[model samples]
Target: MKRRTFRAEVAHVNRPLGEALAAELGVPLEEAARLVDVGAVYVAGRRSRDARTRLSAGQVVTVVLEEGGQSPLAAAPGPAPTLRILHEDEDVIAVDKPAGMTAQPTEGRVGDSLADRVGEHLKRTAGLVHRLDRETSGVTVFGKTPEATTALAEEFREGRARKRYLAAVGPVALPPQGTIDLPLSKDPSRPGRWRATRAANGIPAFTEYRVLHAGKDFCLVELLPQTGRTHQLRAHLTALGAPILGDKRYAGAAQAGGIPAPRCLLHAQALELGHPRTGAPVRFEAPVPEDLARFFAAAGIQAPSGPIRPLEPPA
Candidate 1:
């Protein structure tokens, strides 16, 4: 099924979420809020269901019509695909998203989005409250209802949801701890891709990183993003002179180096959020993928001690 694309422009700046999305889609506020609440809309790929979310002018929003909802998308296939469900309850479910699998279907692409897979696993209706990049493997959370969805969504908006990423980079050169405060914007040369540009129009982005360990020819870096901007970590690392080892689009030597893996050397290691139903703290984690493991073996670096750590919020 082809996705109907809309290059929606925000005429009014920072208007409330319901009002802005309603106006943009020419729908009633109630219906628009309903769509937004159920993960039918995305703000630059991040889920934004809050009716009161402020909009910024020139922001491009994409609305993916839910399968059973009142939209133009085709009927969703039955028997949702299998996925690694790490945690589940009445309020929410968490899954270990694998590399190369999109969080949702896009124009002309038909396969199991994370939501589709989760839907099959859930006895009750389930909806994706957030997402990860196709190449990013790790924890992804979903909400079982609109109330849970809204609460979890607000946690993300308030920057209270904790996230930790594990990345392998080319021979690292920076200090053990530091923060990258670089502004990033889309690469004009390539639509749908992002780059670290100093253009005045760029959005403010920050990524805090620490060198977890350094080995013969690779460095294990821990990343924490303060802003959920597109390609923020990739762009910031590239600007920091230590582009992730296999990041082809953002790194210079990835292709020429003939790196064993074509996929980016980044992993969404962990996630922390409150339980939507119980309001209890919850967390999830995933270990490094096999390709990254093989890369380390090829580099002759000893594996880190201990089991992969469980997800935990900041102390």
Candidate 2:
């Protein structure tokens, strides 16, 4: 059997969910309903079995299509190759995304996207609502329905979602706790890298950081950003004089003296957000990955104790 995937923002508001899905996928209404039955349709990030469910504007829906199939509700093979589900509910799923995994499928790649794996787990299409850098592994949230995706994405944009990141930084001058207010923009001349200067076109970025553990040469830092700009934390930390250890792109040295860096020393340690379905606050954490754990040991530093929540909004 061959399968294809499609995703779109919920464009039709207050319409019969079945009709909306059928129109979007160019399928018959009955096929859409069958897709719903098999959990092949997702609104916001959650699976739905009702063809009558009303959809909201700006919500995202993901649909999986079996190119040649006898029944829309027929089951497929087992789950994806690898995924670590941290928390799940009717509307949302939080997975422990390991380092070096792309959040979504890139073109030309086959069957390896994290989102594809998530879809297999849901027995339907699950969409990534938030993203973490490939080198920065941790909890990533997905929406099973278009509504959930819209709500969760808005929370992040409006500063309601809180994220905590841990980074091992090279020697530099840093206060115990302080905020870095630096405007950032893509360096078109440099391409793919960002600059910390107020380049007139630069957007403002804020990162509040604290020294959780420090030594003469390296320190473990906790970062909370106000903006989700690309490479915000790495650029800000580099501006503060200490680049993240093993971050060769931003840090001049990937290794120093006798110590070696296996990979980028950044980790998305924790995430807290309101439940899309219930509005109740929830938190998720991922202990340091082995590579980072090794870095901590080499530095003779300990991970921060207890839950470290974001203290301030990105200003």
Candidate 3:
């Protein structure tokens, strides 16, 4: 396969370079991003790979297409799913990762995960700083460079990064709001499942929840896990007796109502951390997905139109 290059003029000013390029070439958005990451996208004869760069009107943009460089999102059998990069820079990019997508590759699954898509978009294997459950959707971080990757890992490891989620739970109502401070450990029988324990060897996990609104059958809440433990919130909520809606693994979403959960109603709504390169505090929020928002409305639970707030104010 030969390398293909296309040149176009930016007719619209202040538009994302990737969107412009994608439209110009009719490639998927992720592919446009991959082109930028590989220095295939340029402006003013200078190599520019940042997909989020706003192109000025009259800027001559060039896109060099690498043959066989199909993005995972594009290579999939059907229409590609739409995913957006919330923010990006030289060192890192924040993507609005979709629900039901794995964070990275697994056994027998190579190019079907968010890591694969974003990795191709960035034209390199991105360093995943953190992970969201396959059923959880929200702002996910990917390190574009090795230095950025290491710094992001350190931020989460040192407990400098903060993450918050929005969830819907129901049927057996909780006590308005409360914190679940318990220990968590893997369940031997369930293999991948986790359980709350008070055993000496169990790892401590703290999850806080505040009721946003109460519906006849369900309640919307904002959840914060102080410690990053696998299935922490799901286990904690089960212990609270109000399982999240659509969370069949723990709390049965159908147990709340007759309707089956389309997917786990969990969103990584908020993230706050220091910039990998500058150490400046930065915050990113993912909008409430349309499906989740509809669920809230159907249950008569009010979803916040604005940003979600933590139970306790930021410290």
Candidate 3 TM-score, C-alpha based:
0.70
Candidate 1 vs 3: which has more lDDT? 3
Superposed by TM-score, candidate 3 places the C-alpha of residue 138 at a distance from the truth, in angstroms, of 0.8
TM-score of each: 0.67, 0.70, 0.70
lDDT for model 1 comes to 0.70
Steric clashes per prediction: 1, 14, 1
Candidate models: Cα lDDT each:
0.70, 0.74, 0.75
lDDT of 3 by residue, 133-250 (tens): 9889998998888899999999899988888888877755666667789899888877777888786368899988877777777677788778998988888887777777788787
Per-residue lDDT of model 1, residues 53-98, tens digit only: 7777666666655442435324434454468887777777888888
Q: Mind giving the per-residue lDDT tens digits that candidate 2 earns over 97-165? A: 877666775432222457867887999888687888767788889899999988888879888888888
| Order of models, best TM-score first | 3, 2, 1
lDDT score for residue 111 of model 2: 27
